[model samples]
Target: MSKAYVFTRNGGPEVEALVDRDMPTPGPGELLVAVRAAGVNPVDWKLRKGYTRPGSVPQPFPTVFGSEAAGVVEAIGPGVGGFAIGDEVFGNPVAGGYAEHTLLPVAVTAHKPAGISFADAAVLPVAAATAYDGVRQLGLAPGATLLVTGAGGGVGSAAVQLAQHAGVRVIGVASASKKAFVESLGAVHVEPGGGLADRVRALAPGGIDAVFDLAGGDTLREAALLLADPAALISAGDKQLVAELGGAPVERARTAAVLVAVAGLVVAGALRTHVTGTYPLSAAGEALRAVEDGHALGKTVIEVTV
Candidate 1:
């Protein structure tokens, strides 16, 4: 039997309880993976707490809660291609990632790179996808300046690295404690308090070429005020704020397309994945709490296997 974390009712992290179940079989166009590591994101908690809308699948009691993970493919469905048993892969499993095994759609799973460990690759699908969408939306050119708020968090950190790789100057807004960490990712760090727009102006003087608002509270509003001419901005957190700023909502399809492109980049060694912490599958609740508590410096993952 495979072990999985499931939420029988919408509530806190405590609602996530582990249960033993039979391993799932892959459908046509699916791959069954023996999960090694599962990436934990804010959305996981959001869904669990009913902060975000539930998916189309009816939430039967004991529904699995995780999505992204890295593992070795134990079996591949008849119609699938480009993968085989024993292949190392990473993907967003639509249902239960916090498990010993899970099934993923063939399109979502990608061959894990030789240089990337399962723990690191597990951090890719959700946070990397969000960061990729932000960068892609801006079409940020070399020498351009990009500002990212909440740079200490997973998606924000990924944005900083991806933007820097594109030859754009990156300015990251984080708390004082996270300044050095953000700087290590090749971004100039700014403290979160004060007139953020004014501080950004003091640094860039000419305004930012693009902005990525991962912290969607007041930071997004500040980003709108500091945009350069013909501004481009992407908000990963709040759709209402995007609409309020007259910015386009970052759609899931666009995010997925960006992730596919970035996955190629990761495979090519053009980008790096940052994993801050790993927990045992039994400690999945603690991992989610770390993400919810907003203290994690990078992606937090649950290690389901050695």
Candidate 2:
């Protein structure tokens, strides 16, 4: 039996337990991989608390809690191509990532290069890839002013650096505690909470050209005030609320090619994955809490061994 961190029901952290289960086999166009590392994101816990994306069905109970992982392929599924056993790869998990083994769809999977660690690759599929996609969707020109909400966290942090690297001027909204950290990524760090619009306006006296929000609710509302063109505002957080503000939600290009491109950016040093915490399979709950509490810096990961 393979070890996995699972939740038999939809509830709080208490619902999760570390247990062993039969190994999962790959389905068509999938790869059965020996998981080396798993990325923890806010979505993991949200889904655990029963938050299913619109139009998506809820997964069955006793579900494992992870969406992205990197590892060595052990078996290949039918109708798959361009990969073989023993390929070190990373991608969205077909089952889940918080386990000794999981399945990865070849469509979104990419071979992990030697230069990148499994932990780093694990975080990219979800966080870094989302940031790359949102930035690409905006299609901001060089020197364009973009404001990124929740800049202290994973997607926000990635957006700041990626936008800056693409010659876009970024004003990052985060907590005061992460000012130095955000500034380190070449963004003008501004704290959130009341007066957000004033602070952002003060930084970019002219105005903001676009907003890429990771923090929903009030932050997104305030961010909307900075841009004259509402279409310039997009969020990965709350789609309904963003729509009310005349902005759209992030349209993710969830494909293996996008994964490959972002991974390439990381290897080229144009993008970076800031994994601030690592937990073992046994500490999956704590690893998840780090992201769920809304205080984690960059990304948190679960490192598994053979």
Candidate 3:
């Protein structure tokens, strides 16, 4: 039997529990991973509250609560090639990542580099990859200024760093508490909420070349106004709002190639996971709570020992 932290039904934290279950078996093109670490994100709790990704079938009850993980391949399913048992790897999970074991589809999985730790690799598939795609989609040139809302959070923080690494000047909008944190990523920090655009204007009078929005709704709206061409705007947070504003959602290239690229960036010191918190699998709930509470400084991971 394997232990997993799961939600029995769609609801709040009340529905979540740590339970024992049979070991999972990987199907064709999948690998059963002995999870060493699982990254926590807002989507975990959002899914527990019944938010489904577009076109993704909902997992049945007692569903696991994570999106990405890193571990050794315990077993490889039929038809899967280029991987062997005991190889270290990380990727988006087939089930959920918050478990002793879970399945990872080969299409999204990548071999873990020696330089990256399990905690850092666990977050690359989601947070770092999203940042990678959004920054590339904007195609901002060096010396161009990019505005990143919610810059203190996982994706936001990664975006800020990646953009700066590309020689783009980044103005990060986050809570006052994360000012130092955002600035540490080399972004000019701007507080969020009312008057966001004006403050950003004050920071980059020449104007914002693009907006990579991780904070949606009004924050996205305000940032959109900073761009002379709405086509320069892209969002990972509020897709609908961005579309209505004449901008597009971040075009996610969810492939092993993209994962490899982001992992390489981490290895080269061009990107940092900025993992701020880690919990054992037994304390998965607290890890989820930290992200769901909307104040987690960076990535949170659940480290599983087996």
Candidate 4:
């Protein structure tokens, strides 16, 4: 039997449990992966509390708890190509990822680079990939300045680095405690809160070229005023708020090509998957708490011993 951390119903932590179940066989175009690591994100807990992604089909009861993981391929389903048994791979899993074994769809999976660790690759699918999509959608040029709120979180941290790599100057707004960390990503750090727009204007008198908001609600509403063209504002935070402000949500292209590019960037030393903390599969609840509490530094990953 394969062990997995799962929630039996839609609710809070009370619904979560760890149990042993029969290992799932790979479906057509799927790969059975021996999960080595799983990445934790805010959306994981949100989904645990019954929040569904727009238009996502309803999941069954006793659902697994993760979507991003990296591990070795144990078997490939019929009709799948470009992957083989014993090959290391990472990307979006077919179902939940917090398990001893999980199935991965071939369409989104990419072979793990030798230089990248399973822990790091586990973080790319949701966080780093979103960062790549958001920055590319903005299409800021060299010398352009982009203001990013929630600059210290997982997706925000990746956005900061990706934007800087694209030759755009990034002004990262996070907490004072993360000033040094955000700066290390090559962004000018600004503490968020009251008078944030004034503070941002103090740094960029010419006005910010674009706004990439990772924090929703007031932070997003306030930052939208900084952009001259409303279209320059984009978000991965809240689609409703972004639309109300005349800006669109970050366009996500969850493709194998993007995953390959991110892995390539890691190999080239251009991108760093800063995993700040790791917990064993037994401690999945604690790991989720770290992210849900909003205190996780860069990224938190669950190391599955299987």
TM-score of candidate 1 against the unseen true structure: 0.92
- In model 1, state the lDDT of residue 306: 46
**Which residues of candidate 3, in runs, are more than 4 Å off?**
none
Tens-digit lDDT track for model 3 on 154-234? 999999989999999999998999989998988889998889889888888899899999889989998999988999999
Model 1: pairs clashing at backbone N, Cα or C within 3 Å: none
Report lDDT per candidate: 0.82, 0.92, 0.93, 0.93
lDDT of 4 by residue, 102-172 (tens): 99998899999998999999999999999999999999999999999999999999999899899999999
Which residue pairs come into collision in candidate 4? 66-97
lDDT of 1 by residue, 26-101 (tens): 9998999999999998888787777655245555768776778889999888898888899998888958799999
Per-residue lDDT tens digits for candidate 2, residues 188-238, read: 988899999998888789899999999999999998988889999999999
User: Which should have the higher lDDT, number 3 or number 4?
Assistant: 3
- Cα displacement (angstroms), candidate 2, residue 219, comes to 0.7
- Show model 2 residue runs off by greater than 4 Å: none
Cα TM-score per model: 0.92, 0.99, 0.99, 0.99
